[model samples]
Target chain A: MSTLSLTTSIVDATGRMLAKYTPREKINWGRLGVISVPSVWLFVFFFVPFLVVFKISFAESEIAIPPYSDLMNWDAEDTFLSIKLSLANYIFLFEDALYLDAYWSSVKIAGVATIITLIVAFPMAYLIARSEPNKRNLLLMLVVVPFWTSFLLRIYAWMGFLNKNGLINQGLMAIGIIDEPLIMMQTDFAVYIGIVYAYLPLMILPLYTALEKMDMTLIEAASDLGATPTQSFIKITLPLAVPGIIAGCMLVFIPAVGEFVIPSLLGGSDTLMIGRVLWDEFFQNRDWPMAAAVATVMLVMLLLPIMLVSDGQDKKEEA
Target chain B: MKKTSKFLTSSSILGFLFLYAPIVSLIVYSFNSSKLVTIWGGWSIKWYGKLFENEQIIEAAMLSFKIAFITSCLAVILGTMAGFVLARMGRFKGKMILSGWISAPLVMPEVITGLSLLLLFVALENTFGWPAGRGTNTIIIAHTTFCLAYVAVIVQSRLSMLDETLEEAAMDLGAKPSSLFFLVTMPLIAPALVSGWLLSFTLSLDDLVIASFVSGPGSSTLPMVIYSKVRMGVTPEINALATLMILIVALGVVAAMVIMKRQHRLNKELKE
Candidate 1:
């Protein structure tokens, strides 16, 4: 009995030592550690940054130096004084019809672009998804390969195609399709083309994922029951694909609302977006507080919808 | 049936043409012997020569590469750790919030993300007296913060598909947990890690908005240089640079795909 007790104690001592030398033994501990790193990083770089911007939104706007200079005034004790924490910036947004107009224009453009992209990408996604498996891979590769290039380069390439003396205009004039060079660049139509070209892949990816996961057997069974092709599609395929549609729409719409590069490159000065406005305020006008206010508004609008969709998605996944 | 298939084929062709036409024009015009970007002269390598001679563009390109390499490496590490926990460990309190925050930047507006980071830097400088000023380091921090989401999502998805039994078997063999991770789990997820790293690298290299916000004077990235230059006047030398970039990226993708296919086939044969 004494030998048995001695052996048990020996094992316990070694196990304790081993546990001490190793990482946290509790699963919760390790998980928490893992969660904490990204959480802290996000809190510092993302969440806190936004909070800082929100603080700046309440600050007084002063520009003496060049753009990208100090945004706030600090006291001897390191307390911020410029952030007067007033309602002036928010109030300014309400009174400024131009800002409100830009926001509405951005929303309308994003909506129109999402619908157009859906129309274009849906057919392409459908074709790719319904094709033979071997061929589908190559086709999807073709779709994604363009995204490898710098996004701005793609927009630059569009300028070559859309300018008055550019390829499209040149081709049309040379072929007698038009009497004169067409003003394709710096137009809202050009903006539409630029955005649709850029974001079409975003739309296609989720749609393809949705279509790939769909059970063809169900569709066949529906058809075997004497239902029409469209009926089978509507009943079996559409419902299952709704998640992808939502995901795709959100992906496209959110970015389109904040798109500045496309608008600046392809559209006229009248092309108004919140992103462009924010950029002008920060970089051109040197109004950091006003820029922060614009950014805060965008963040608020996006956060609510994202949370709603994500919660809905989580519930669906759980079900 | 033939008629319908023909229609579908034509539409696909048209879509492909629409996508490829601009790219082809850009490439062709890169070699044009003309100063004007729109009008093409005889084929020549003059633009390519000019592209190499431009010191500003070359410097920006090098900066972009250096930043991309470091950010991708760091992002892949943290993302892998987070993904391992999310996939292997069961849920606890704040799991939902944790996941949400992980993916929030993936969909967040670039302007907001950039603006917010700028604000953070300004605030931090005033308070901590560290990070001295924004430059390469700040740009890297901002890039890593956002690109980590892509890496995490990719790793999490891959881990979900991985067989958990392998890790269990390793543990049962009395292998230490740390050794088990390095020896078993890492080897299994190495492909996902590679792809995630590549994705993050490309994203960092391509980013203009966030980089613009965080980058300081003389730390101008390739896209920034190109943007400022193009805004002044579009040039053929940029076309040459763009074409070269497209070529390099295409090669990378094709190589990755070939390797992945071979790996898949080998795995299949072993299973059989």
Candidate 2:
């Protein structure tokens, strides 16, 4: 590799001698060679898997013995071509109201939860960010510490808190806040609570970064200009923090859209989300092709937020 | 006159209460001695004791730790390398595609990722007679795939922020590229590596949807076990386990904060 690159560079310099283009010796081809190994590793292990998923989504589902089919059978031409690739799965997706309903419900739930999460997390993250420098780290740690535990465990903890005769209801009834239990568990409300609760940190972290990096002098200058606190916040603070806010929203909104565990654990039977539907199709219903179609749709829906966040982060980092 | 302070105090307090109350109640009730999960007949460590005695839960916890440790290590190694390349290498053919692929898993829902991976594994097994079975190995592979993306993003960002002078200086001093990396670049990015490893470890341990989809019948992680137990019936033992996890996590966070603080102080002193 080195010899080839060296010869190429030597030739390039000579080749470009009369071409008026400058020659560069340090091509960093060696670094690329080293980098290529892991790049290929990710491509094979991560990228190819998704490609296979895309391929399978266009194929007809076939039943076989438990687990999967025999390995050697794929080598044969007849068996290979017999797999029958087509768009039947995509057509099936359009025909299924359940799949579409689940997708809509996922959007609604995630949308509401994201709004509520921003409302709940913004003030706290703001206060923490604006706090004294010595205490700032401690406060940030406190916010993130909850996330260090199992995300699923946090959702499960809500089970005890939301169960009928659970602490929240029992306390409410004892205090005469309500005449009856709120029926908090196994409801859409419960699913919303779980999602917001689990993803709150994700929102806060980016918001905190944005807020903490803002110049306090700007707010002070606005105050000096006789602007009210709320005015200063809306004009100076919020606008400056828009990138962070966008980043945070993108982070929370994308994953929450396809969130399954929270809804499955906390949602009632009436609750419908695409993730749950996808899980049912693949695992319970044993409809691999249809499930793949659902996943493909999710992949498309998820692309927007993913692009938004990645671009937002890149801009923030560059700035 | 003092309305804003009062409102701020009240609202902040309310927010804290809302966030911490459910978790506190869950922790407190784990000590309840009664069979009824909701009722607080008395405080005792009986649930914790029972949790220890449950062989299945214990095995699951051990299995979870094993998987988390292995997968996190694998993710850090693969991800750090990928990160280094993306951070250091200038634009090349397929660079955009490579970067997009790295970000895909981070945004993809766990269920979709799980299903897709399962399909991939089945396809490979059918094609090449390799990875003949699905179980622990498959679970590890699936987790490493997703977790590697996260680690790569973190480490890549850190690497991008790094001063390029050190590596250049090392290279000019007659050090080989490989030696320059091990001596200077690695040390400079060590914090990001540690952060990546911890993040991956936490993710692997926290995962349930992907693990459930990919894990074979006999190889259940702690979260999987807890999920099944919760589905079967609410158990105080789960609360006990959760509370213990909280304690461990809290300690880890506090330690991390202290280390970061010390490092910051050292950097300041060096500058002075």
Candidate 3:
């Protein structure tokens, strides 16, 4: 009993000592450890890169190795630090019809492709989500399996299928559908096909997740109340799936806007994408500032739609 | 169960067909004995054999593998910390910036990302005189930036589902915070880390445009090699390469699924 009492007193003393240090104080240091490593790394790599791009966009292209004029000119003579900023790069993008057309075409193509994806993915996702429990996982897995395959290779697969002498044309010719090949590849049609095909999983998975978790009882109640299937779907299912729809559209649209691989591989030379334009400016034309300008503008173009989407979602939530 | 409508069922079938047909054709044509890609001569493994004999492809694959291995390791470590912050840390200063920087990479255009990273490297080289020339190092860093976000999202989702009471209990039992994390939290989130690592590995391997912007002479990745070749035109050898990559990825996906299912079952059993 004496030994037990001694141990209890020691334990009690330690407990008091532990209580002296609030968990918040201890967790603050822990928070710093967790936050600093990744945040600093992102700041240096992710955030700093954009800042560099922004800075470079303000500088002019030069013949020197870096191919861009320094924004801040430090003159060693007479204690001078001169900062030169130019809007010429941004102005040049406006002056060129090529840049304007590329930007517009990118938005149109991505927007249409996103709509197609929504039309294609919604029903398919619904099919999987509404399936028997045993088959639901398998169905969803099948949808995502192709996403794991190499993205370039999948786009390449479309190239093989859509080429002039490619499989589809060859098979069509063998059956004597037309004397001429359909001229499908190196066209906007092929670009659309590639984007839709490659990004299908992204569109489907989100819709499936949202649909699967939906309460079935609500649907049954709507039906019991003598609402038409279409009416019930419009009122209940459509509104409920709005979050998934928005998520899916953004996923499909964002990368599709600045696509290089699909457009370059399967698109005609005449088909202009901002990504290809940026590549040409930076690599082919060796104009780093112009490329930075193109990228900055493209980022703004991408963000506007996203902000609007989020804003609309916010208003809906408030309502 | 509600009967699936005919339209939905048919459309789903068509979707699967659209997704699988090209891949199936690619796989089937990989074995074509004829040099022509579309022509189906009797099936043979000559392209696969030829692929092995090519020195350029072999070296490129090795370099890609090395880069991917390094990228995944760095991404997982840094990403776990980011994920912990997102999931565990209450509101903090600069959380807005942190969240934006993290999620922005997920949907950001590859060209923009690639361009910005390349510029950052060039500026750093000019100012700090480090990363002297772009090569595998630059590619790995660029890849880790995006892959880190992917991992953080995965790990964050996993952690959101985690029970906090267990950590509280561990602390109450006199476990130090560091030990509590390593012992209690790490084990629970190990599966996410493994999957995140694998995803980062594949993403690094598959990247083309970003690697293109940052890569220097003699350090061409496999995708870079393939991109140049495929740009000229499709080749039987590329079909062979595509076939091999698909097979490997399919196996990996199946393995991941099995592991995740087993983990779920184990969790359920433990709860019971």
Candidate 4:
């Protein structure tokens, strides 16, 4: 019995020592599997596609199945690889006033909508942030409730409200406020309303989180030091909220520029956002290469803003 | 301070009015018994009754729910793994690229993502002769790619906020790593997983642009159908549909709020 006990204790000691010493050399199959699965999936499905897009952008459009020329060509007669790189699509984009105007108007519309969202969101966020703690959760939840509902439905709601003979016009007529139905649908105004309505929560949530985290006592102290409330707000609150504003604006503006739904549904035929143009070029015109070129250019244009957003996030994290 | 508060109060009220007026009006008009959608004839449930008979909508909704269900489940699995690596795995090779891949989808425009993904599928089919065509499967894949990002972000945050000691203690008690994850870690982060799932479902359900790009002629998603309908014009049936959707969302919100309150109370009691 003693010999058996002694052998068992020795085996246990060796086992513990082996576990301790060999851990580094051991291959963790489980961890490796966890890491590799997502990485491979994302690499194939997310990252490589952008490279494909970039490659396709430089190829010529053809009347074939996929409708774009292969970038690399090999000839059997000669042992040589030739790349058929064409910038014709990009050149076409620059030469075409439609593309230029679409880019310009998309930027303008997105920027204006972002500014409006900010104006509406700030007060709403501030109100929630400064409210009694007991009620803040409910208030914030209310803000998020609209977000949880159908985004399309929210936009569709406005479509009905702003229709020529819809609720707004009917109500106005009943109130003796106007002679004829106001034409609000199929206009930039409608697009702006849709954008602001859809993106308000995006703007507000970040602003609320930022504003709530702020030092309320700093504003109080500034006021105690004989500064007026407006002065305290400008000096203290506004500067601090700049990061939130940037984050919020980026959240709204980045997607807004490439927005397809708002422009198609709300804006008139003359509304020329690049997103719609790309959609049309692909589906309507069947110009795959040209569409790829448009998408590539749009991405390049957005790179600066995207870089700024990431850099801001890094700095915010450091702080 | 008083003046600012007053101004803020008024602006906030206006903002809430701005946020909710259109939706409330749409819901109200859904009940109107009228040929004209906007003009109220009387109160009737005809639209709701008619909505039940719409085969196209029913088919489209079934398709959307099926897609969302598959997408959410796939996303949670892949996303949980991704999030696990991000939160628990120390510095490793390709960490930067992996993280960038995960977060980039959050801000990337739907148009660009859709275009690139569709192009990818075409190229893949050309080469591998798989994913034979764009349809519900393609839509599921596209939605999963974007939805996984959300799940990863949520799960990562939840994991980070969790106390590490609980997990360490479980390990000390001779729990295998796999068992520890399922038994302890998962239960603690179940709320985040649930939120991620719900978020994925809603996002996949509401998606129009990406689904449009990936979906073929026969596989029309609910959003695509609704987009076509809304583009033509508003209908009372759409109003009824919108109202029904709003009701579901409202119910979900209430349930979430109740659960959150209960969680808060439990935490407070534990502290005592």
Candidate 5:
């Protein structure tokens, strides 16, 4: 019968495989192989580098090949331990107004940019979400396709638009609105424009996802009870979209805080973002320990937002 | 109600215009004959010729493409494995730590990630004498590390949505674990894998900050080259390059959308 033939084939397969390992051993090995590759990779590349930054932050700067003193050294007679670990770099960060000012400005700029992006993106997301179902995909694609182009190029485009002889200025001049071209390039205004433009897509996608999934009955119910459209939006829709807002704001804020290219290319000497500071310390000043300290401080500052995002993900999964 | 709807439609149109105007201008200026990007002269394609003639740009672009291709492949393999374990593997020791490691890159600031990886490369070179120097290899590794997180998220979501009954039935029919995976699970997750690959590819290609940190002399990626040139000022040649990039990306996106729509229609018809 078929059963007998199947049993015979199973036994033959087991007879050939059981010589090397059991089924349980095979599964365990497979599982280990699956997990170890990424685990080892993350530990070596991601986690260990963080520890290195921490380690380097404590060492003294030196005009040497590695550019930092060893954390520990031995005396010539080998009788004493010479520890070179110092808080000079961190102390320098605290003592310097440049570093403090950079941090403050970075927070202010990124904060304002996040608000602007959210305000601009919210209406678009709501409109797209409320559109006819068949048209929603096409609208969403329009928002996202621009994101596929090079970010650097898009930021570069803003440079052309915001320059003194740029499009905005030229248009204003042609319309006789101004006698002189506006000094928009290399100003804080330019920085804000660049950040908001670059990060708008990131803001829109999350908002759209949340809004599109929202039940329409909530809004309908509110309207049925005589709440005006604006009142319903402020009271019902905005409150319900809190999760998306938080996600979108975090996405915009965190990266914007450490945004180097925008501030470097678009911002003038007045805009001293922490990322630009870190870059100058590392590349221009050749101060590795100082740069490491800056990076470490930034990581600490960002830990809260990162935790909130991950925690948000966990809550969603649980729900 | 009618007023609100009209307002919403106008706002949406304006929002999209804000998004597209700069790009449209960049493309338009690429055709301008003037050396200055803002000024309008006669139309010309001379910049496109210059863009192609630049050996440095060509080399950097080729390198970027090669790195992106390899990074996406590696990221997919490693990410699929990590995602599979997260979705299918029941609770095990250190699950929290594993998941944390997998997701950390998603929210970590690029500056920090770049600095840490650069430091790691320096340390590795000092200790092992391998990697020899920081360049394409380091950039690819850094890209894979982050892109892996994205791929894992996509694949994990896809896996969670898949029905388990098919795999169970396959096992009940005497399929080994490996055979069950290939015959049942892999085919089901093919779409996720494809999308994951594309996402990773684009991310690797678009990276600038991290590549700036990790790339060495003569190994500058396209973004690095473009950033350097763009910092000086917007030149017509750069505009030409940007125009070409936009055209390619636009074409790719359109092609993908069309294919996805066709596939959706096919599925609906089959169901009917």
Candidate 6:
């Protein structure tokens, strides 16, 4: 039968492919197979999606099912392929003050939050790293334990603490500190608190790693030379920990710029963040192309910091 | 030095208090008898009971767990293979591209990732008529895509730090390549694998934004449900649920620390 002949040919092809490699070389093929699994998976799901976003960003918005017009269409009557593309979305993003303000505020807020987190986390990391060797791991574990809990719940907890009748207000009143509750919830202050609280662990770990690995002998030598402790810290410790500082800052800043949940939950309606803008454009207005444009721009903005962090990591690995 | 030590100790205490205060308050309010989360009434277990009775929340939690479990398992397998390849295979073609592909998702924002993946699913559905519609399957794929990056990084670092001579010695003893891997490399990397799995599981379970994009009508995860509710305002039931989550996570962390400490002591004793 024809089916039998086809099956034989299929088997013949595979046998020929296998025969191309010697027994020892076949292991190399297996290695290829192993490496190919994740590479192919990432290519299909991660890389390809980004390409899809790029493609869709050039298309026009439509009321159709997918909510975006196809870039290429087949004309049935004329029997010809037609391509349609527009730069209006990108132009609109540039022209609109709302989008501009969102980007500006996102960077400003994330930057401030990152700086505050570093100021708080630096001393904490130094203390942990400088602790007795036997006790250091316990301190490190305490820092990491908070990170294991739910992020959303942590933010929600902040909401409770910041609300009008919340604990912070009640505590202040009970202690006769203030007669009125400070306007904290649904404000920019709350967003900063949520971000700083959530990202503190991230900022601490790298700093701890850097500080722990520092040479105590250098500090001791500096002190022996009659340099003050503060002077030695500034002269030696600060310079050595720059890599960690940069790494922690980028780790906090990059994601914080594109953050949605914190701003949405904790920020006031007047708060303008690009992540919220993109969400609204896509989900509310059903403007896929415009949303894609926003995201693409956001990615471009974040690209430099991301590369800096990754490059720093590579250097650290090399060292 | 004494003055500096005092400063360090006090600062460390304040830092920890800052970190834990909100969580402690959240837990305390979960026991409040009143529906309002801020107003303190007499203590009661009513919210815990109410949380159990809510069928929607129960269903959502189960779905989130199911997705996380499946995502972590797949991520571990794929990630381990990728990690092994990166650690062992040196100076290969496209190495830079491969490494870049592995690390890119780590820094990519969740919103952009979600948007792009959503578009991919839609386009694929339209073209191939497969994956039919977005739901749990789509969410799993999206989650695994990101989670695998974390697992790969962890496993890769662990593998690089390991001594490769053990594998070579195994081979010299006439062990086959596959067996050498299973009996030697796997056992050595078992700790890394466990940690990687736990990290992936937590990341998938904690996700809200990416899940929101890829999930469909009937497949809402627990975070999605909680997010919708939290948007309106906090409720006693949510506080109760959060407390339970915190307790479970705290227990897991404590157990892990205890085990790690025991292992450390055992290693020291063996060396001595």
Candidate 3 chain B weakest ten by summed lDDT: B90-99
Model 1 agreement with the true structure over A57-140: per-residue lDDT tens digits:
877676443233344457868674763366787899989997898898988988898888887777678788888868888999
Question: Pairs clashing in candidate 4?
Answer: none
Highest-lDDT candidate: 3
> Which sections of candidate 1 miss by over 4 Å?
A1-31, A64-83, A312-319, B1-7
Runs with alpha carbons beyond 4 Å of true place in candidate 2? A1-30, A66-83, B1-4
Residue-pair clashes per candidate, as listed? 0, 0, 0, 0, 0, 0
- State in Å the error of residue B201, model 2: 1.2
Q: What share of the true interface contacts does each candidate keep?
A: 0.50, 0.52, 0.70, 0.67, 0.60, 0.68
Off by over 4 Å in 3: A1-28, A174-179, A305-319
Question: Clashes in model 6: which pairs?
Answer: none
TM-scores of all predicted structures: 0.90, 0.90, 0.93, 0.93, 0.92, 0.94
Q: What does candidate 6's lDDT look like per residue over B1-272, in tens digits?
A: 23457777788899999999999999999999988778889899999999999999999999999999999999999999877877876534444456667777887878999999999999999999968999999999999999998888888888888768989899899998789889999987887888788888988998999999999889999999999999988899999999999889878877877776776587579659
Regions more than 4 Å wrong, model 5: A1-27, A75-81, B1-4, B267-272
Local distance difference test values of all predictions, in order: 0.81, 0.80, 0.88, 0.87, 0.86, 0.88
Candidate 5's TM-score reads: 0.92
Residue B237, model 3: lDDT of 97
Model 2 quality (TM-score): 0.90
lDDT, candidate 6, at B74? 97
Model 2: per-residue lDDT, tens digit, B1-272?
A: 11335555666566667667888888898899998998888989998999999999999988888988999999998888878777886544555556666876776788888887888777888769768878888889888888888888988898888779878888889999778888988887777788788888888988999988888769998888888878755688898999998888778768866776777687679769
Looking at model 4, how many pairs of residues clash? 0
DockQ of each: 0.42, 0.49, 0.50, 0.50, 0.43, 0.49
Candidate 3, position A33, lDDT: 74
